[model samples]
Target: MIKKFTLFLLLVLPISAFAQRFSQYFSSTMVESFENPAQGIFKPDTTKMMAFNFFVPNLSASAYTTGNATTTLKQYLFLHNSTFPNIYVGRNNFNTLSTNNNIYVGMFKMFADLAGKQEIGFSWQIRAEGTAHFTDETVQLFDGGTNFNNLQPYTNLFNDRYYAQGYHQFSFTYRETLSPKFSVGYKISALSGIAYDNTTINQSDIIFNKNQSDGTSALYLNLIGQHRTSYTPGSFAANNVVPNFKNPGLSVSFGVEQHNEDGVHIQYNIKDLGFIHWGSDPHIYNFNHTDTIGLSSGNAGQNVYNGASFITQQGGENKSFTTVTNGLAEISATKYFWLDGEKQFKYNPILVASKQLFYNGIAGAFINNVQYGKVTVGVMGTYDDLKQFNLGGKIMFKSANAEVFLGTEQLLTSYDMFRAHRGNLNYINSNANFTGAGIFFGFALKFGADVESPANASSIPMGEDEGFLKRTFKNIFGKKPKDYINSPGATSP
Candidate 1:
């Protein structure tokens, strides 16, 4: 009965979910600048020459889950699968799943020059990235032993993988405006790799032969290119809590923006095109095997590499390797519309297309942004390569010297879950699975006088008329939003 419930959940549940990637788009705080260095120069905050931001510990995270079966928090934590009826296993059924977590704390050390003709910015940060993937056949083999049904031949079914890394980055950015309509910017980063691990099953073919009368079974298998790396065993007695930064890497980012006199703007950004080179100390192993196992043989012992048994045979090597970092590329277009005669309320529609190159996911979204005075609110509808549609929202408050914001990608899912939980209804619906959710929030402090002499510098007057975007910059840098009309040489839309 437990097995039947597992199978039911696997076959019936919606299979895709991810974190709030779109929240950063409408987030107007200084912390958002770290996501893309080009944003550091956006609109040029003239009042702030320096800024600092800290992600409250355990408050910043991004995670995603993909699988053949979906499980809810209630079912996973409380319910017993044995309460269900007879199990039905589908033929030609193969399930593959992956979950990734990136826990990061950005001490957004940022510096900028707003009054200069050529804008310059710099930042340093630390990040920890981790990922894991597994296939249903791999789990079945572990749970049921040699009990696989002999109805069909299994080929390329051992699809499992994992990767984890920690690193620090120092980024330097520069931007220059060639004309009122066009500007270009670029950022280069030096990456200091702290630790790394990766594992994957490249290929597999297996067949099970079961004797009908005696209930005996034999297995024929061919598996190849199972690769892994580890740093905590044998000669590498590394620390359990501290990071090791013996490896290093480099990356570069570039962006371009085009804005018109009519308040229509387009921007593009390509980030983190780089690779990391691991050291020789970490054990890199590769395995390949072809063998037959009888039921009485008790199966060959596993644990090939990383001290975990992944193949029928332990076949691999120990060495060094290099891997490319998963980077991001995105493009967006935004246009502002006046909502009132006083220009105190405005509406902006935005379109963004983005890709995660390594994870192999593409996403597109349409966002509506509404700004009234120092507050901004946004709603977005997004679709990703996972075939998942998501709704997201964001709210922000900004002043001349400080800003704070919070947002989420699964607003609808969260709301529905709350309502269902209150009414005592089954939270797991048939159409959609809410396996994961995340929220992002942070505060920043920007302080620097616009003039060389501190005595001559005064806070920006509140009565000036400035566009919403410019007001955002001013508020971020400690300047008040204004109602300026057609300021001279104004480049931002």
Candidate 2:
């Protein structure tokens, strides 16, 4: 039982993926309160408003293969349907295999204002995240069948790593305008961990030798490693899904924004900046088991044979350790262009770049958004270092007291799923690897302040120093001039 469980835990779970939706930039939905706190004050209304957002969930996953393999999700899934060779190993080099899955459910989120100038929000979320990485040598030993005996003597192989955690989050946010052009916002989160596990390898190797006399030969093995697991018993059961507070953590997200007279805005944000320290009572396993086993008949002048596997497992004393939260760093610029002389209709072009600091993933996107009256639409093109290329869009309707939106990062897959084709399942028949795909659908109900008019809303009041400097510059120049740097309007199309 222990051996089976160890193998499952070490080899099954994989890495993580980013769950953020790029369409949020154009939706103008209340969920932006969580995505970018500074947005809390951007609407034109001054009256206090309240809103609840639901079903805004995002999922991300990816598979790792040989350097020359098909890395895209669609291509990999197609390949999986047909003929595929055994694991590919680089010549005298280590081949890597990795996988990650991460999901976020908004559960329930709402935002309200302490006053017209200040916004406050709260949310409850559930998350499942994990990652697994291994090397070719490890794969050959376990999956190669008879190939295990062919390992070169004294060859060094290092290839075993994994981490997984599950938890629930409660968050609170506050945002306020420092000046009309400047605003700052931040969120504080408390996490209740449900489960956790990780493993680190120290040393592993195999040695082969043959006896000179009529006897059975033996192979020598040495393995060393440590692992940790923690969970409140029964916490994962369907009927007892609540995690205990015995293992809790805290984190913070903070950001600032500045926009000028034209529709141009610049913003910077750092999110999920914290860590979780597993409780002192977590379980620990240290492996140091090794043995020599004989193979072949002893009647031969010399026989070579051995079969010994299974790492020793033992309970460990209570010790606490920390795991960093999935943090992110982001910077973006957005410019709006008016489509009509009335300024009631406009389009915005946005460019954003972001990084998952903890997972070492980078992503960027370009989005074009058009809003006229109560309807807004957006299209986006996105890519990430993880080999994901996505084209998606969003459509939304807003009223004085409500908003609804539907969007997908995998629009093509969603369309295929709805058509006569087998949807993404088509790739499953091939020898392809399905990396990741998801859809986002959610709605918001609002109460208070009338819906602000996007075209007629007044801009933030200028800071005293800013106004004085601008006036002075205009006087010296004989006429007010364009602010190429801090101006609000577009620098280009």
Candidate 3:
């Protein structure tokens, strides 16, 4: 029964989820520039004035599910078996699922000017984020009391939280080089919400009592906390998934890049630091702890959820609330060296450290790339504070006029999943640690006139152009003298 419920949830989601690909850093792809904010993507004479994906998606997707339930996931999702899953319950066993999805439906950029190497872009993206946290007993309660001992009480087994959201983002970005060693950029976005759902059980307990009449059991469940959703349960229609201003929000991202005196390039970025206010009319459920339900012979587990909702019918109709986006802060250092004597082959390495803004977690990664002319290949490894480790690689074909890249950022997890589906997977101690799978791919094209400094180009006139952000800054704070490193014509001043 737990297998069927979980499978239904997974099937309702998009086939591909998203994860960050560290190898894309310094690759000069459009997604990289948009993600990092301050990274430059144009060559003075080689790149075109305009670049776009031409409606082709520049997408990155990956996901991970950790904890003991994954063994059962391996069975239903992989082995295609009919075995009833047995979860480790009443012993504080737990499981978690984390996933993200980013799809760039449209992206367009052009070299706006030369001062500070200024560039501007416009983009439209559809994104989704989610996480699920639950104990093994939580699953056991849903399908029946097969894993529970009658006359015994399980404490806090129903404590869990599940939240998922998707939205559309329209953004405008600007980035400029302050000097050869310094650059800064920013992105401002307006978000239109598509869907939102969250449920939490902060404190809960359950007891199974033997039923003498039908040989089944009676469930005495005490539940606390609340549930929130934008639509009625089992009534999420096609229109509910469409973008509407009924729920609107905003977000911003910024990044800074610098070249240190030691020949290393350092970059710092803060992404998606904002929140969304859901529609005014939303369903909210606050659970009360006094509900005793009778378990049927077959569908006992699913009835638990129905019983919880029934207990909250009085408070389920309420106003909406606000939620913060998953924000990130990260720093990385990069250095390159010529691999051969002739200098035709170049090798670059980058080390990165990232933090979750709203949570207590961090991840560190190493990326190594070798470039020969227009082709490049690289490998990467990352470990998080939670002890999760991932290994992946990338291959790219990039020239001044175009770029294309594809790779698995979670190769080990993908391989493990593949092997499990083939019915030949094993763990050293019945523990797979973490299980996941994903891939990232993107392509972009460049055309039109050559991108050049507006002050030096015959096709562009400085008198006809002034940056929107620059003008706005001066208008709000008054004009100021330019710094030595910020002047357009002062290369060595």
Candidate 4:
């Protein structure tokens, strides 16, 4: 039984495709000095500056099968239980659910000037970013069979499956100022690790057989097997499997900021220009090709072909496959202006154009301002390949010296054709419409005061007596002081 199951796993494993989507958070934002090379511009005033930021996002979707062909949901169910029956499944029906969550923490400090210029400041920044995803699926069989009779006499069969993935990254950035209004920065990052766990449970009495006479018979066996078995939860448990996953990559960026005499400030940056490859390589598996003939009760002697064949049965036949690498790139710019000279009231409306250099492109904008001294508001819009267009807004309040940003992104594009295809299936098909959208919310806070500017040098002072004596000696000589001094100090006069 173990060997048969192992063979089954090997056969179906290559059929599953895993594609990691680019993060919207990473896409919509501009590249910081840490990720770009043109970091030798704009300087932040850290003399009394402190900041904090946070982001949260959620996405949910479903779709009906296109035409009569098997959808991703159906394929998943069929792979797990080859004998399960298919029923009507639509956009409202959810055979699988996947959720992703992320959190980010950033902090920095600036001190000490380089090259004897107060305009040149150095700072150290650390960023801690984490991501977690949970996927739950429930597959149901439409076939009426006793093979799943353990749960019910002769009715519906269902299975519940769960999957989880998590990872974290810690990075450090160094920023240096080149001018009073411009600075450049670079960041070196190392990913500590990553992990993925998946679990599948057959709630019905369905059993999968390497050899089954018909579809109905296969479904019945799968149902019966599921009813007789119990699965334990945890990584690598008898019922759970964990895949080896890790991400290693380098990121470089450059940014520039300029403040005109009119107090109009603009900033631009490019970021995340790197790639991450999963450790797993691609391979093809051969399914058993033997056919089984009937061994009916009346027919005592009948040849049956179970379609069983060895991997080399077809004269070393092999299939080719390759794994896809995941990577991202982005460019963004923003403009800020003060509504008041005192800088108490500031209007920062920014336009951003960004693209995943390797995967996708997105463009958006945001407007932020302070009203009532403690409240802030922002509105944003973005276009995505899967969700066409998205519109959302956020409101924030400062309390206890902490600031929070609460807003949604891609709200309008969640139900488009793009979302239906990619979100439902792990694979990207050319025929699939790619306009899908997702939403996210983020927060940032400021802490500590900006550092003080360096002290200025004072002019040198001379004694009044020296000035008076020089004037008196010049008058007595009736000539220029230079001539008197050159004449041996007026001959001891």
Per-model lDDT: 0.54, 0.57, 0.75, 0.33
Scored by TM-score, the top model is 3
User: Which segments of model 2 are wrong by more than 4 Å?
Assistant: 1-14, 41-48, 54-86, 90-116, 136-158, 206-222, 232-240, 291-315, 340-345, 386-388, 410-426, 429-434, 448-493
Write model 4 residue lDDT over 295-354, tens digit each, in one string.
Answer: 333221111112111211222222222212223344444455567767666455555555
Output the better candidate (1/2) by lDDT: 2
Cα shift from native, residue 459, model 1 (Å): 15
When 2 and 4 are scored with TM-score, the better candidate is: 2
For residues 329-447, what per-residue lDDT tens digits would candidate 1 score against the true structure?
A: 88888888889999999887888888876766688888888989878888888887767677888887776567777776667755654554455345543233334444666677666
| Each candidate structure's count of clashing pairs | 13, 26, 9, 64
Off by over 4 Å in 4: 1-100, 105-166, 196-249, 258-266, 275-327, 337-345, 366-372, 398-402, 410-450, 455-493
Winner by TM-score between candidate 4 and candidate 3: 3
| Local lDDT at 334 for model 2 | 93
> What TM-score, over all chains together, does every model reach?
0.71, 0.69, 0.88, 0.45
Q: Taking the tens digit of each residue's C-alpha lDDT, what string does model 3 give over 1-493?
A: 5456565445343321236647788778899888889897887777998899999888877767777776666665655432334477667777776766788989998987765567899999888776677776766566566667647677777787777878888899899765556777999999888778877878887777776576766788777888888766767778766667788989999998888767888889998888888874578888665677778866675577677666544357767888887688989989889989998899999999888787556888899999999999988998887578888888999999899999888988887766765667573123564788787889899889887654556776555233454555556756522344455765621
Number of colliding residue pairs in model 4? 64
